[model samples]
Every structure is written in structure tokens, then in C-alpha cells.
Target: MWNHNYEDELIKCHRFAVGLAKEIDYKNQRLLEMEHKYNETMATVCRLKEEVKSKDTRFLEMKQKYNESSATVKRLMNETDLLHSEMRKTQSINRKPDEALKCKKKELDQQAKELEESKAHNDLERRSFLNDIEKLKEELQAQEEKTDAIENLNSVLLVKEHMINQELQEARKESIESLQNMLTGRSKLGIKRMGEVDWKPFGDICSQKFPGEDWAKISAELCSEWQEKLKNPHWHPFKKVMENDEPQEQIDEGDEDLKELKTKWGEDVYEAVTKALLEMNEVNASGSYAVPEIWNLMEDRRASMKEIIQYIIKQLRAHMRKRKRC
Candidate 1:
């Protein structure tokens, strides 16, 4: 009996060892995945660092240019002041020569001639100086504007990069949260501890809706369908504006429509979509006037249908091109 008890204990120990070994193997797999993710993150960080370095170099170059431009403007300003003083001296000399009671008026005519020539030369110099000043001021303003633009770009780039990283993190967090919720909800339902209002069924239904296929292909197909839907005339604005055809009223109305859409769709997607639409409309309008009715149709169709509106203009362009060829 003692030997049998000892054998049973040995069997239990062997089973425990196998289970522990399996757990260790599972942990090792997870470790490998974590290491792979870490390496990928490091590579991404390196790329970002290089991008930031390039941007910084560009910023420094712009700064240097701006300084040089500012210096040139200051020099021009000084030259302008010197020219003004010379003009004042010439004016005073003109007065003295005209009023001079000495040496009689014998050489007055010659002096007057020389004075006039000097005046012409001085006037030319003054005009040239003023032009130079204006040019330098314009250059300085342009440089300042460029610098500001570059700074804004730098700030925007940094913000966009940070937002991208934040979005990636949020996506991962949301995915994990969703997975956890799904697991918990499933477990609750399985154990009969879920309420009538529990959403497990809905979650499961949604999960079933996604086919186990390439999501990229699925997205492409969906976008193509949307594009087709947009191209359909059912959504087209009758008498839509073209780039060369937009009247002031129509432009204002379009701007209003854009504002409304932005209010409705939030900013991002609306901004992207509206800007594209505006470009298309501007191209179609091309500084030409369209009827108010046409403008109204555009406003009406834009909300309910965008692709159809674009398609109509596309057709018009094609028709015009054909006519021109004929």
C-alpha cells in the first residue's frame, strides 16, 4: 500500500510539471511578440527623429535668411535718409543761388543751368533711393511672411506628428478595451449572470457581420460604391457652377453651405471633403456667372449628394472639349 501511494504522488507531480511547461511555452510566445513590437516602435522613433532633424535644419536656414533680409532693410532705410538730406541741401542751394546779390546776375543763367542739371540728377538719385527702399521693404516683408509661414508649418508638423502618435495609442487602447469588454460580456452571458439589457448578442451579431477577408479590399470596394453613388444623376445639382462659372452670390452660398456642413460633420472629414468640392466648383465656375437657380441646386444637392454634382461638371467639361474639337 505504501508503494502504491508513493506511485500516485509521483503521477500527480508529472502532470503538474507538464502543465507548468505549457504555461512557460505560452509566456515565451508572448515575450517574442512583445520584443517584435518593441523593435518596430524603436524603428518608428528613429524615423521620426530623422524627420524632426530635417525640419529643424530647414527652420535654421529660414531664420538665417530672415536675419539677412532684416539687415538689408535697415541699410536701405539709412540710404533713404541720406538721400532726403541731400535733397534738402540741394533745395537750400537753389534758394541761395536764386537770391544771390553777389557776382551780379551775369553767371546766374549758367548757375541756374548747372543747378537744374544737378536738381535732375539729385531727383533721379532720390527716386532711385526711394525705389530701393521700397524694394527692400517688400523683400523684408516677404521674408518675414515666409518665416512666419515656416514657423507655422513647423508647429503644425509637430502637432500633426504628436496627434498621429496619440491616435495610434488611442486605437490600441480602444481595441484592448473593446476586446476586454467583449470577453467580460461573453463570460457574463455564459454564466447566466447577464441582464436582459446586456449587449453581448449585439456585439456577437456585429462580429459576425465582418467577413474574414482583406479589410483593405473591402474598404476599396465600399469607396468605389460610394464613388459610383456620388456619380449618379439622382444626386446631381441641376445647373451646377463650374470653375469658370461661379458668380459672387454662388460663391457666398457655397461658403455658407460649407459652414453648415462643417457644423454638421465636425471639422476633419468635412474640411477635407468641402475643400475638394470647393476646388471642383471653382474650376467649374472659372470666373463665369451661373444662374441663381443653378447655385440653389448646388446648395440643395451638396448635402444629399456630392458625387452627382461633380459628375455633372465632368460631363459639361467633356461636352465642351468635344465641341471645341469639332
Candidate 2:
């Protein structure tokens, strides 16, 4: 009876394992389907971008053709007007018979009617061309909006993919731990195996790479590597490092210089000097000012200061030149 019971429990465990394996297989197939769909979406976005580019090129070509056609029509109309003027002069000078004159008048009336029809047709074509241009503009705007939406969707997908990867890694870790526990649980039966793994000796590897380099040089190189790693403008670590690196003495000296300039030159000269100094820097123009109070005051008075200083400097420089020449 005991042997039968043991066999029954083993069978039950086997059935559970089989069920888990089938579930895993189904999950893998679903993952593959999702991956295929992601690939298709990416391909579609690429094709759409190419199509939009082609459409823009075609639109520009059409616009140029329309402009050229309009110019040709205008030239033809001018030539027709000149010919009409010449015909009128000839009619007056020739003094043909009254019936011939009436016939000529009838022919001129038909020609005028044809010309008016041609002008109306040309006007219709111009309106149609303008409508086509407006349609293209609307399409371009819609395409741009779609591209932006796709970009946003891609960003969201990237975040989801990262989350999925992290979860998968955690699952793999849990599986490994479970396997290790099962092996250890078999130690009482003398069925356990043991081995050791050690971390690579990073210090030894470094020593081997730089066999004769001193510790000081290695330390300095490491510090430089760390410095490069920390140099992100948006990161707090680099900003803090930069602020600390500025010597107190140098900062005090700079403050003293600014104070003295302000005290001697007053607010106007101080503002002008600050503007000149800031304007001298290309980066300052491109980037936001670090010192807002100083920069704002200078920027507010910049145009006026520019004109006044320029005039004053020109006079002073000319006076100095004359004195030197004399």
C-alpha cells in the first residue's frame, strides 16, 4: 500500500511539470508574436517617413511647374495684345471698303471672345493649382503630427521593453536560486556536487596591464577617468565638483574686483562692463546665464550702453591718437 501511495505522488508531480512546460511553450509563442508585431510597426513608420519625403519633393516640383506655366501664359497674353494694337493701326491706315471693315470688326469680336475664354480658363487653372498647394500643406502638417505621435509611442515602447527585460532578469535569478536550493537539499543522500567560483582580481589585471606604472600615476589616471565620467552638464555630481574646484581665494578676488568696479563706476558702468564681458563669451550667448541678477541688469541696459560706450570710446581713442601724433 505504501509503495502504491509513493507511485501515485510521483505521477501527480510529473503531471504538474508537464502542465508547466506547456504553459511556458505557449508564453514563448506569444512573445514571438508580439516581437513580430513590433517589427512591423517599425517598418511601417520607416516607410511612412520615406513617403512623406517623396510627397514633399513632388509638391515642390508641381509648384515650380505651375509658376513657369503662369509666366508663359502672361507672355503669350502680352504678345496677343501687341498684335491687336498693330491690327487696329493697319485698319485705320488702310481705309478699306465699308463691308470689309464690318467683316474685320466681326472677326475682331470673335477673337476678343476667344481671348476672354482663354483668360477665364487660365484663372481657373491658377485657382486649382493654389488649391493643390493648400492640400499638400495640410497633408504635410498631418504627416508631421503622425510622426510626432509615432515618436512618442516609440518612447513608451522603449520604457516598456526595459521594464520587461528587468522582470525577465529577476525571474532568471529566482530560477537559479531554486535550482541551487534543490541541489543542496540532496546533500543528505551524498548526491550533492560542490564547486567554487571567484571574482576576477581586478587589481591584478590592472597591475599586469601597466607593469611598471607607479601607484601615483595610476591613481591620477583613474581620477581623470572618473572626472570624464562625471562631466555631464545636467548632473549634480559634475556641478558640485566644478563649484568645489573653484578656489576660495580666486572667488574672493573676483568678488573684490566686481565690488571695486561697481563702487567706482556706479550701476551704469558696472552694467556696461558686465554686458561687455558676457558678450565677449560665445557660450554665454547660447546658454542660459548662470548669474541671473548680474546678467538681467546688464541685458536690460545693453542697447543704450552699447551706443553710449561706443561713442565715448571712439572720442577717447581719437584723442589719444591725436596726442600721440603731436
Candidate 3:
């Protein structure tokens, strides 16, 4: 009986041990599965940590970029404010010049209007002055015509006076001749003794003396000879006498032809002819002493007193006309 009780106790003990071993094996398997799941979870946790680090780096870069953008925006706003200030100052500075330009434009317009008015006034005055000048010219022409008519009348009166004086001189000469005839106790017909001189013989002698010379040249030579003779102090044609202890000139009876010519033409006529010949020689040493003819084709005769006066008037009128034209 003790052995059987002991064997039963041993069997119970072995069976309990076997059951514990099976529990142990199940616990080991469950633990292995838990460990594998933990490993996988740990790996997932590491990946998550790396993703968070990368995200943190990107966020820091974005924050730095945002700060730089803000700084740039602030600087741009300062520059815009400064530019606005400068524009306002420029506008203020230009305002005065613009106003001055407007004033200057107004002044130029006023000056232009004044200049146009002055030009119109000048034109009107010039036209009026031209009309006045025309009127003055007409008055001057009429006055000149009146003066010319008066001058012509005066010239005619002068010529008539000269003719009257000539007639008076001729009457005085005739009276002198009559007195000379009575003094000489000769007939009145004997007063004309110049015809007895035979002037043709004297002319023939002059022609012989001066060959190839015309009457004009012979006369010039005679005038030169007389001029030279007159310069000689001792070559007096008249006789000299002592009267009151002073020398007096008297007629030279020895020169019958000269005395006859002097008695026939009067002392005044003889002196006038001599003076005229001397003046002609002095004025024209080489040219003819004869007067030029107004009409070369007309008859060779002296111009009448009326003709001479008419010629002088005509010459004066022609000269006045030429002066007016000029």
C-alpha cells in the first residue's frame, strides 16, 4: 500500500510538470510574436523621426526667405517716398518759369499790335507827304515860268536901251566931226578923209608881207605887233609936248593916215577898237578873232539888234529848260 501511494504521487507530479511545459511553450511563442511586432514599430518610429527633421529644415529656410522679402519691401517703400518728395520739389521749381513765359508771351503780343499800328500810321503820313511834294513841285514850276517871262521882257528892254545909247553915241560922233571941220576951215564933205587912205594898197602890202595867211591870221599878227609896240616906253604914236614943265600928248600930224582915221571915227571909237583887238589877242593867241556865226549857211552879214536880242532870249530859255529837267 505505501508503494502504490507513492507511485500515484509520482504520476501526479509528472503530469503537472508536462502541463507546465506546454504553457511555457505557448508563452514563448506569444513573446516571439510580440518582439517581432515591436521591432516593426520601432522601425516606423525612426522613419517618422527623419521625416520630422526634414520638415524642420524646410521651415527654417522658408522663415529666412520671408525675413529677406520683408526687408526688401521696406527699402522699396523708402525709395518711393523719396522719389515722391523730389517730384513735388521739381513741380514747385518749374511753376515760376511757366508764369514768366506766359507774361513774356503777353508782352510780345502787345508789341506786335503796337508795331502794326505804327506801320499803318507811317504809311498814311508817307502818302500825305507825297501829295504835298507834288503840290510844291507844281507851284515851283509855275513860279519858274513867271520868272522866265519876266526875264525875257527885261532882256528886250536892255537891248532897246543899248540901241538908244548907240544912236546917241553916233550923234555925238557926227557933232564932233562937224566941229573938227569948222576948226580946220574945211567943207563938211572934207570931214570924210578916210576914203583918201587907199586901204586896198595897205591890204595888198599886208598880203605880200604875210604869205599863205588869211585875213584873220593877218589881223592876229597885227594885234601881236601892236601889243609889243605898246609895251615900248619910247614908241608913242602921238607927239609929246612940254606944257607947264610936264609932258603932254598931242596928235601927230606926221602920221597923216592915223590922224585921218582918228578924226573920222572919234577918239572913243579908236580907243574901243584898239582895246578890243588887244583883249582878243590876249584871250585867243592862236584862234581867229572873228565872231562865230549863229547860222553858217546864212548871208555873211552882221546880226541886227532885234535878231541878237531874240537869240539871247532863246538861249536863256533853253538853258532854263535843261536845268529843270535835271
- Please provide TM-scores, in order, for all candidate models, with all chains considered together: 0.23, 0.26, 0.22
Superpose all Cα atoms of candidate 3 onto the true structure and report the RMSD in Å to 1 decimal: 50.8
Candidate 1, residues 84-177, lDDT tens digits: the string is 5665676678755433433433344445455455555555655665697799999999999999999999999999999988976565444333
- Model 1, position 56: C-alpha lDDT score: 41
Q: Pick by lDDT: which candidate is best?
A: 3
Provide the lDDT at 40 for model 2: 99
Model 2, runs deviating above 4 Å? 1-102, 129-133, 140-144, 167-326
**Cα misplacement distance, residue 72 of candidate 3 (Å):** 67
Clashes of each: 17, 0, 0
Extract clashing residue pairs from model 3: none
lDDT of 2 by residue, 1-326 (tens): 99999999999999999999999999999999999999999999999999888875755565565566566556656655665676678678875645654576566566656656665665676678679879999999999999999999999999999998887656544543433333233222111111111112223334555678774466445434323322323322111123466722112224454467467435543444343333323223222232111111223432232343353466579889999999
**Across residues 125-218, which tens digit of lDDT does each residue of candidate 3 receive?**
5566568779999999999999999999999999999999999656545544433423232221112221012233334445665577685466
Q: What's the distance in Å from true for residue 35, model 3?
A: 99
Q: List the global CA lDDT of all models.
A: 0.50, 0.52, 0.55
- Candidate 3 least-lDDT 10 residues: 187-196
Q: What local lDDT does model 3 show for residue 125?
A: 56
